[model samples]
Target: MENGVKKQDQLTPPPVPRVAVVLFVLKGKSVLLGRRRSSVGDSTFALPGGHLEFGESFEECAARELKEETGLDIGKREYLTVTNNVFVEAPKPSHYVTIFLRGVLVDPDQVPQNLEPEKCYGWDWYDWDDLPNPLFWPLEKMVRSGFSPFPTE
Candidate 1:
């Protein structure tokens, strides 16, 4: 105890690395994306996702986020590659260890709806060959790394 105070170990530890679980709901030759309107990655296209909750698995986080953000429920959560994203140029610098997830919609007719207008502008399907510009940094990284959610028939 220096200066009449306890050692640093007496204090609480820092938070863990931020983890974002994203779901890629694949359709025929296209995947779903939402136009973001939030502070971190505003005006860019992003997949449905959110921060991983404590004591939750990746698949549970993905399914929960999808339902909360887009009002679409998905099953058969398949683990995909993860990306380490650091956004240094944003108004608020941030980092995320993004866990990618793939799932087909349980109902083919169940399309995405904008459940959180405050965070998302809208949702749409984008073909991999023609993705929207200014993609979310993690997604851009994923594309640049030659990752695809589509399965070869």
Candidate 2:
């Protein structure tokens, strides 16, 4: 009504729900990380993850995403934490609900299969005490919160 024009009510859209998986491969205080492919986000180091599909449980999504991205089959999932924040690099700006899970490699010698060639390049294991700097922002927070990237207990 500022310029003598009648204002109309605008319907606000609902926030988009996003899901992510954080996998920790435990090997005496060491964890697994993957180098994201050149296309996904920064293509830097990050945990295995992706968006959740409709009607899929968070745990299932975690396992599926981990397997698809890293080619490692996880046996079980342990719930850790959920983070709500704006994901800038996602296809759309929306709320991200991160589901942290603890998993173990079914076979240590099996190399990860990067299904998405444009999403990840390779995978590696790292010690919790000596995590690489500039880790994915959310993952860095998970580490700082004293929650082991690979939860033991």
Candidate 3:
């Protein structure tokens, strides 16, 4: 009881689930990924993505996040699959349904830059068979499920 009034913790509402949009920019046999440096999955390699904004479509979120995180524009987006990520070991102990999308770079010669230096350590291309160590949970789940972002030439 506080301020002469009774309090009940059970009355508190549960937190809402979150959604994230992840895009795999494919160019031939390589895919773009960044080394995460944030609290959620620090030191893990992850695709370019961000929290889904309210009232935004998956395609829109993918494009926005790609530009915001990599400074590269996407041409056409292909809907991939969604992964339900429950990060029990996360610093915030959060859950997310990550929508995956794949697309090619609009400009073949364009290079990815470290747009968000505080969150990521720039972007680099990695082959499917040889990815960096300690991948983010969602990406690891996708990989372990035999989900190939690049299935064709």
Candidate 4:
């Protein structure tokens, strides 16, 4: 207690960091990305992925989120890396453990569709070396860490 003010024990505990599975769906030297339309990373360039559901594996999340957001079916996805993302600049602060994966599409000719317009603007392939400005926290952190989703030739 300071002065005449007394602070009680806070009932709400800190939130645990959530696991978000993000994917790198590539075609040649380009990767798939979409502008987010929801809270947290709203309006920022993000990959087609979402939070990891309970009882779901990382691969399952990679497949589900991709199909749900972009209507693109992935054949198989392998783990690439993980990022510790804490959105301190967000309007509402959040912490997330971002899992990265490299996904191969089931059909190479199947173009991506915006299935969830409420969550994303649209899907487009962007050159990895020349991405758009204002990337999502996790992606931006990965870029700053000198990480490349692509395999070295």
TM, every model: 0.86, 0.76, 0.89, 0.88
lDDT of 1 by residue, 24-60 (tens): 8998889999999978878999999999999999999
Each candidate's lDDT (Cα)? 0.87, 0.71, 0.89, 0.87
Model 4 lDDT-worst window of ten: 3-12
Find the candidate with the highest TM-score and give its number: 3
Better of 3 and 4 by TM-score: 3
Weakest ten-residue segment in model 1 by summed lDDT: 8-17
Comparison by lDDT, 2 against 4, better one: 4
Give the Å shift of residue 149 in candidate 3. 0.8
Clashes of each: 0, 2, 0, 0
Best model per lDDT: 3
Q: For model 4, how many clashes?
A: 0
Candidate 4's error at 12, in angstroms? Answer: 3.7
On residues 36-114, what C-alpha lDDT tens digit does candidate 3 reach at each position? 9988889899999999999999999999999999899999998988878787787777889889999999998899999
lDDT of 2 by residue, 49-151 (tens): 7777889887888788887777788776777777876766766556677777777766666667767777776677788899876677678777787876544
Candidate 3 local lDDT, residue 44: 94
Give Cα distance to truth, residue 40, candidate 2, Å: 7.3
**Model 2 CA lDDT for position 145:** 78
